[model samples]
Target: MSVRLQLTDIKKTYRAVTALNSVSLDMMGGKIIVLLGANGAGKSTLMRILAGLEDPDSGTIQFNNQTTDAKSIRRVSTLVFQKSVMFSLSVYGNLAYGLKIRGVPEGEISKRIAEALEAVRLSGFEKRRAKKLSGGEQQRVALARAFLLNSNVLLLDEPTANLDPNSAAIIEKAILAKKSSSRIIIMATHNLNQARRMADEIVHIHNGEIVEASAPEDFFENPKSEVTRKFINGELDF
Candidate 1:
């Protein structure tokens, strides 16, 4: 069965600054929702909340029509940050850690690790030290690790930002390959072209609020909000 997520009246503040203001969004499984925004527009903040890494000051989250808390959300969500973090271990070890803790059998862990690495174009790098690889390679390994979880919600914050074209392309392909009826993929990116290519729906955020949400064709060609139009045309200052 498909899953649904709803965030209602979300508000967050960091001391004197407001990060999110009365934000509400509904997402369903099997779709790619891409958030577009400038720096500090709350895209990362929202993703963090969804991933259960952080909590909104005030909000209600419903997963599959039932209210849930951060811990429950965390159980079903996987997040990949723009700056990937790696353990001081080999690629195989890093990928296998989560599976082992979940009580997956040794044979299945090996098979899944191999498949995940191959998906990220890192096949045969199992013996390499994760922390010693190039930045792009590390990010790919991070993506591979997330893939092994097969979480119901996949949250990506600029997953392909600042990488070589080949690495970025490979990551995008692997992400698309993982889309299924039982999963939801939400990504935040400033790369308009990448957003256009990967997004099933484009959501524009500004100053901690959602200004517009529409399909890629409508969002790029005919934005309704003046703020959205300016953003699309590169007139809004970050």
Candidate 2:
């Protein structure tokens, strides 16, 4: 598989405390990668950098043979924030918002919106006001919005957090159904069970540094680092 994104010598800082310390990795298209880390481990920071939400103090984010702004990076990739932002519109309106922003034709918008809503199992809620939906439903709308954009790289930060088991399952099904050679799904998850079920590769971070990077099966079966082992054993703090 071809590498879709390459990070080299990446570094980010928030004042004196370094959020990322010289990290480097290559993410290829066509796989689900779970970024595992504890609180304050800088997993979110790296996702922000990859999403072009924040500039790294030092390093490179190379995509499609070019380095560009977050907006450009954003065009080929999408991020699903933990918090869902619902506008004063119906579920259909929110799902079609991204296509509208990109100036997709009305015909295409309709098709994309229908497909996305189906994927997230919100098919019949087109007329429902976004704000009126439950938390999980709202998040499903957000996921539909991102999926409608048809991005190559999808970055999710705790996508299932604060969601009920059924809602989480629906979202996971959608994610699994969409994995393809032209797409990459990277999610930061604290739930090991989710990682086991979704991740092709695992990235374990500790105190802002990558302590272990391995295939999910190997990582769970034989975690090399003490920290990673502890995490799998449910001994680490949430």
Candidate 3:
């Protein structure tokens, strides 16, 4: 019953700059795959392509044994950006928007919103304007919004960046709570510590290519590449 995703020979370019170079990965069911990279290392570009925000110049994507298009990919997968955005609406409104678009009934929408807010530990803030929340609070709300959507696949980019310890912990709890055998989570981040805590597998990208992919323990404690070693040693910036 495991879900599976496969990308073969993926490539992307921006004018003369290659953002991804024949990258390929095979991922399956209910595991966290953390993408690590320095700045401009193509982590975001790879995530965006997977999220269907941008098309790979050349590639094939197969999810659950079926090839799919961007719209179809997005229907079952959701992405939360590094800079979270909330509409000029109440928290309840923001959370309910996607459900409404998907034609969920009003009763179900209310129930999901309540559950999502509780999951994110913002149970009493539905009536508050989303934009009025603090950065951490806003990110949590964004996360709650994604949870309410209940997509089978989720992608998060720098989800806890710049947050205080408490807020990050809360967000981490929400993420862990959402993990299930029926879902797949792919996250891109620069936080080595967070990656260590959250990742089942770590994929290291450098110069738009995946240089290393391994289990977290092996990746962190016994990296195989000089680049991965340098990264763990804090010798590389970006």
Best by TM-score: 1
Q: lDDT per residue, candidate 1, 1-238, as tens digits? A: 9989899999999999999999999999999999999999999999999999888899899999999888999989999999999999999999998888899999999999999998998999999999999989999999999989999999999999889999999999999998987899999999999999999999898999999999999999999999999998899977
Poorest lDDT segment (10 consecutive residues) of candidate 2: 64-73
Better by lDDT, candidate 2 or 1:
1
Candidate 3 contains a number of clashing pairs equal to 2
By TM-score, the candidates rank as 1, 3, 2
In angstroms, give how far residue 207 of model 3 lies from its true place: 0.9
For residues 1-238, write the lDDT of model 2, one tens digit per residue.
Answer: 5547877888888989989998887888889999988878988998898777888888888886687666777778888888888989998888888888889999988877888889998888989999999999998999898888778889898899999999999999999987887888899988889999999999998887888999987898888999899888879765
Candidate 2: the clashing residue pairs are none
lDDT of 3 by residue, 111-228 (tens): 8899899988999898999999999999999999988887888889899999989999999989988778778899899899999999988999999889899999999989999899
Model 3 per-residue lDDT at 132: 96
Instruction: Give Cα-based local distance difference scores for all models.
Output: 0.93, 0.86, 0.90
Cα error, candidate 1, residue 21 (Å): 0.7
Ten consecutive residues with minimal summed lDDT in candidate 3? 176-185
Root-mean-square deviation of each candidate, in angstroms?
Answer: 0.8, 1.6, 1.0
Supply candidate 2's per-residue lDDT for 220: 86
Residue 187's lDDT in candidate 2: 94
